[model samples]
Target chain A: MTVTMEDVAREAGVSRALVSIVFRDVEGASTATRERVREVADRLGYRPDQRARQLGRRRTRLVGVTYAVHLPFHGELVEALYAAAAPTGWDVMLSPVTARRDETTAVESLLDHRCEAVVLLGPSLPSRALDLLFARVPTVVVARSVPRRTVQVVRTDDAAGARAATEHLRSLGHRRIALVDGGRAPGAAERRRGYRAAMRAGGLDDVALVPGGPTEHDGEAAGEALLATSPRPTAVLAFNDDCAMGLLNTVRGAGVRVPSDLSVVGYDDTAVAGLRAVSLTTVGQDPDALAHLAVTRAIALAEGDAASAEQVVPPHLVVRSTTAPPP
Target chain B: MTVTMEDVAREAGVSRALVSIVFRDVEGASTATRERVREVADRLGYRPDQRARQLGRRRTRLVGVTYAVHLPFHGELVEALYAAAAPTGWDVMLSPVTARRDETTAVESLLDHRCEAVVLLGPSLPSRALDLLFARVPTVVVARSVPRRTVQVVRTDDAAGARAATEHLRSLGHRRIALVDGGRAPGAAERRRGYRAAMRAGGLDDVALVPGGPTEHDGEAAGEALLATSPRPTAVLAFNDDCAMGLLNTVRGAGVRVPSDLSVVGYDDTAVAGLRAVSLTTVGQDPDALAHLAVTRAIALAEGDAASAEQVVPPHLVVRSTTAPPP
Candidate 1:
């Protein structure tokens, strides 16, 4: 049988209301009474029910995170979010989005847990769904931007990063540079726009844009497609590190040497990108900076602050063994 | 602006008790009354406070998970856990242990959030801490064993897995084999015992065990040490896949040809192990099975069932490009 607060109050010879006030830690009861009630509760193994306390109080001080378990980049962001939330005296409540669990389930679980706000990492939810969410609770979308200004966003400048990658190849005397399209992935349009702008600026009209995705298998398929194209691109910029790695492996396995035959650059310099075997050149997003800003903005908004504009962080290229002057 | 049950009751022209019964789906209200109350509540945007309902109920149906965000293996297990818990109608709450957040803090926060049970993934907590935690709330420790038989455990047979890895190397006609120790990590001791037994069984007592750890950096250091020994071993069994990848990279960087000059086998066939560039031969633990058993045990324990015995899952070795017969 579970011991209740009423049992603790009876044992302590105090009113149930006084015990409740002490448990809530609000301005109430004498110090001596508080200590006595705590002692009684401990002796009786009575715990103040977390849910009951929420009904009696106004704050939970929990910041919920909705991130994909499969994505290593999201894992890094979650760790950074914990560090960022530590200083604000708010706890992080994680509700992971897995293959079986959808975004709505993840967000609803957090809301059900009484989290003051939520942080969606690389969310794939539609704008209208996000709008419905923001209407109910404060939300911050990280690593992706939504159309509405009403939702807070902390994201990397995809266009600039894409431009930098393309220009890096162009400067290496590679005239035929290609970009593996991310399809409808968040910020894919911006990267495509950036690549086109860079190619136009370099007077390189033959832009090779092949359909790809954010995974390794997608990159492998894209690699086959690239290899089959007439006047194949000497260089390819992948949507992300996984795609880059897949493409690198496929082309290498097919007797095309990386850097010497084809140069590949990946985005989101994840941990795998730094593996000695996979030494991928890619764009690095600052997880700590983005996480810190997102947490700050989320806490402020939860405290009834006005909706703020989107905050964009700059991404830089990390050169490694995968990139060299095109053959 | 929060909507209260009082507002719903007033709008529906019913008592607060009637509204509560309707939301709780209890047997108090008539069919018409329940429908009218729900309609009024929806119009008022009155979500039943999750916390308040806990005070009025006996179960939460929440299984809290304590895992490290930095570990890919943990990420995989978390995904599996979500899949496992779905059939049981329970939701998982993740509380990741980061560099700054200790395991105790992680567990306590979940406790404060009203989680009914906890699943510790590759937990590094000492026996005493675990004992306290298990005593308070039902816990299932996955991928690791604890001291007490009273506590529920769902783990891989580490010794069996290690023995298989050693025998795999031995069958390749490699007399000189080394074991990269996991050094105090869970299952490290069992692996050591298994390797020692295998060496004795093979009558090839050239046991070369180098101190290592769970991370890739530790493997690099172990690789350096292994390379320094007189009459270097031709085959090495690494602690885990990350360790194996690191050792492979480090030795390759030092100009050692893999499989011809040295053969490597790793434990825990993580996704990285299957990469075309790093096709590591490794022992594979089935995450789905372990997760299923763990959720079953945890939910059962939380439901007032007697503590069941530890559940052991078998592990199999996956042969890839990294291992071959001795040169």
Candidate 2:
């Protein structure tokens, strides 16, 4: 049997109530009695149970976060969220969604912990579920669009970022540009729409697009397809930095020079994009501003402030060696 | 003031005990009364307090996990650990170590949730602190080595993996090889020792060593230094896949051909290594086996099993398209 507070009390020759007070580290027990009770508890190999003590508290002061493990950008945002929560006296609890674990399971774990508010990072959940969640608790959706006014939103302007990327390549005299789309991802549609609109505005009759996803392998596949085209595009815009890097490797392997032969642009300037060896030109989102807005909104809603806010941060183009005038 | 269980019970004309039974989903409350209480609670915006409910349960069946957000391999291992723990009916709580947050703050959050056992993935804590943690609760350390026998350990044989990588390059007719080290990471020392031993075994009088760390930028720096040497090495063994990829990009940019001019080898066959565009030849550690051993040992210890286990899985070389005969 496990040792309990009563067992420590009996060994230390003190009342059970005194042992409880000492173990909880709260006032009402004398210093000598506290020391004696702790010694006896230590001798009995008894650790204080945090769950029991939490029952006596009125507030948990916890904010839950659900993030995908594979997204490096999401990891950065989580780090920033910690800093954002420090000044507000709130602790952040993370529930990670991996390949094996679904978003539902992650969100359920957060609810089980009784977090006052929850922030879902790049959530793929359906709109109805998000609306229900917003009604149930103070919910903040990041990197996804939600129509409900009850939920708080924090996201990058993907369409504007994609338009900027296309216009930059067009200004460099690249008429044949292709967009390697991220199929079914949260921000894919907006990016695709932006690319199409920019191409139309540039008076390009023929628009090129290839199927891709959020991985390097997908980028490689798209690159191979681009190489096999009748007239290879002068420039390519990938869904994200990972895809862009993959395309770069594929193109370089085939003896095709970047920017000189085919200028490349990517989204989400991750750590890999900034490396001296890579130096990928990409669209960069301000994760600090996104995290700050999400945290502030969640805190306000959790603290019974009824106003829900929607925040949209613009993405900027980070030009490097990857993009140049096509030969 | 926030709505409480007592307020909900009073408004619904039901006892607080009955309302709790309904909230807990226990069979004590009648169906009609349960629906009425839930309806009244919803109208009053009263959510069930999980902390109060958790106090009545004897076991939490929660295993806390601590991992670094920057390490992609750790992310894969975490996914595998989740699969391994599914059969045991235990939930996982994640605490991430990031640039802004320290391990202490992360661990404290897990302790606050009252996790039954903790599985620290590549912990950077000192041995004395690990021993103290083991005494306080059932603990398992993955990737990092601890001197305390009370704590369970699961790690790859890093020295053997490094030796295999070196030998693979040696077998490809490359004599002059340089080592790009990880620099103070968990398995850096062992890998460095293994590379040195393999070089000496191959009877190479002059061993080339360069200063490189865990990231791609470090690899780029090492590559720059290697290029400046009078006689550049015929082969290079990077500390990890990230470093190798960086070196590959650097060498390519300098008009140096891989495998034909300088054969390259990397450690830790990460997802990026397996991509067709990269196709990095590296050492592969079985993450599934490592995660399984750690989770099983953690569960056994948490259930009061006294036998502490130390598990070391061997690493094997994955011969991809990277290594070939040197010019």
Candidate 3:
């Protein structure tokens, strides 16, 4: 059984109203009485319910966020969210969707905290749940496409990003380029569409799509599988920077030189891609634009503006040392 | 500017108790009345106070967590914390401390959610603030040492871990080993102490301590500086895996082969260290053990168990491709 305010009141020989006033930090409570009430509450393991207090307030000034802890690119976007929220006098509360916890658990906690609005990054929730969530709170979904006008959305043009990466590799005179797929990740299917379109555009008859997940291990496995083929691809475009790093390292470990033997391109252009040693050719998502749009839309909805908006930003190719004319 | 339940009651011509029951999803309200009240509430943008309802309950079953979003190693430990909290039937609420958001903001949000206790990972708060926080709730500090008996603590033996890394390099016929510092991070000072003690114990008179920070860029800078010396050190032990990766990549980019020209060792054998592409030799902190102890201690303290325990776990070395007999 949990301790209650009533229990604390009884223990401290005070009325429940007095205990409530003290817990709320109101001026009605005297100092000695406040100290005594706090001591009694602490002894009884009682905490004043914060959500209850929030109900009586005019504004929460809080933006609920859902992000994956393991995704490096997600971390960058979250930092950007803080900056965007700062000027608007809004603070962010993060609820991480980890391997052990599902997205529902994460989102529910945000609702329980009475966050004014929500921002989801690369959310994997079903459309129905997302719809329900948006209906419950002002929501802005980032880096994924949902039905138009269902809720606000800010996403990169993933297909264009993939196409640019493929075209860059093709322009380097590489005929065979493989794409390490992101599996069923938010932008995976769109990126695949872009890759295929670009391959056909370049007049390449053969297109290879390797099975891969979002992690570095998946990229390593994909690299190994691609290398074992009778006719290896001359270049590879990975799912993201992490997968790209895995593929790049695997090939280099097998005594194959990067760019000189096999050119590689990664997506997301994360911090890792720009590392002096990794210097990967990749596609870039405009985080600043994405952050600005998401925050603006979220705050608008929270303030009861109730206008649904959808914005798609283009991704650009970042040419680094990872690509070269195929050997 | 927020709508209250009283406003909803007046709009729907219902009693306050009826409105509360409808919002709470409890009995004593007809379907027609519930719908009417809900419609009015929605129109008014009124959300029921969840925290107020929670005040009547015994347990939130929540453990608040504070972490740095950008730290990859911190992500690993958070995953471990979730797993550790699972069997105990507790859920975690995360508040990320990003570049734009300070630790105080993160911690206060946790308290607002009425979490039973707080678990801080690599917190950078002042000692006085930490003391004040612990006084307010059951707290467990990880990866940083605090005054004994003030609060429960679970951290790796940093000095020992650093000493072990130094000794391992020394045993590999490397007399000129330098320490790349983590500046003033949680475990940096202790690790530096261990490095110095180990260097002195190894009978090496000339010890090199390089100025480094916790990021990969800092490591890269230190690597470049070290390499510019007339007779560069044979081996370098970096502040953490990020810094080590920075140093390793810098040297490798400059055509200095690992284990042949410059052997590198990183700390905190993070997920990155185990990647085949970056098989870094580093010290391992048992995240599972640390997580289990921290959660257990936190729950106990929350339950009013007054016993204060401080535990220091051992750090072991994992030999990988980054380190070998120095040339």
Q: Score chain A of model 3 by TM-score against the reference chain A.
A: 0.82
Tens-digit lDDT string for candidate 2 (B1-327): 557799999999988888888887889978899899999998997876556655666677788899998888888888989899898878677888887878877776777677788999988887778788887778888986665456888999988999888888888878898898788777888888888899889887568888898788888988898888768899999989988988888887898888788888888899999998888899998889999998888888888998566889999999998888888
> Over 4 Å off in model 1, which ranges?
A1-49, A227-232, A255-262, A275-279, B1-47, B148-150, B223-232, B252-261, B275-279
Report chain B TM per candidate: 0.89, 0.82, 0.82
Q: What is the interface RMSD of candidate 2, in Å?
A: 3.0
Please give, for residues A1-327, the per-residue lDDT of candidate 1 as tens digits. Answer: 567888998899998999888986887899999999998898997777766666666788878899988888998899899999988878788888888789998998888777899999989999888888899899999988787557899999999999999999999889999999999887788899989999999999998899999887788888888989979889999999988877876786687878989999999999877866567899999999999999999999999999888999999999998888988
Collision pairs in model 1: none
Instruction: Please give, for residues A21-111, the per-residue lDDT of candidate 3 as tens digits.
Output: 9976779989999999999988887865555545455467789898898898888888888889888867687888888878998887787
Model 1 achieves a DockQ score of: 0.46
* Higher-scoring candidate on DockQ, 2 or 3: 2
Q: Worst 10-residue stretch by lDDT in candidate 2 chain A?
A: A48-57
Each model's DockQ? 0.46, 0.48, 0.36
Kindly list the interface RMSD, in angstroms, of each predicted candidate in the order they appear: 2.9, 3.0, 3.8
* Candidates arranged by TM-score, highest first: 1, 2, 3
Candidate 3 vs. true structure, TM-score: 0.79
User: Could you tell me the lDDT of residue B71 within candidate 1?
Assistant: 87
Q: What is the lDDT of candidate 1?
A: 0.87
* lDDT score of residue B212 within candidate 2: 91
For model 1, what is the alpha-carbon lDDT of residue A300? Answer: 93
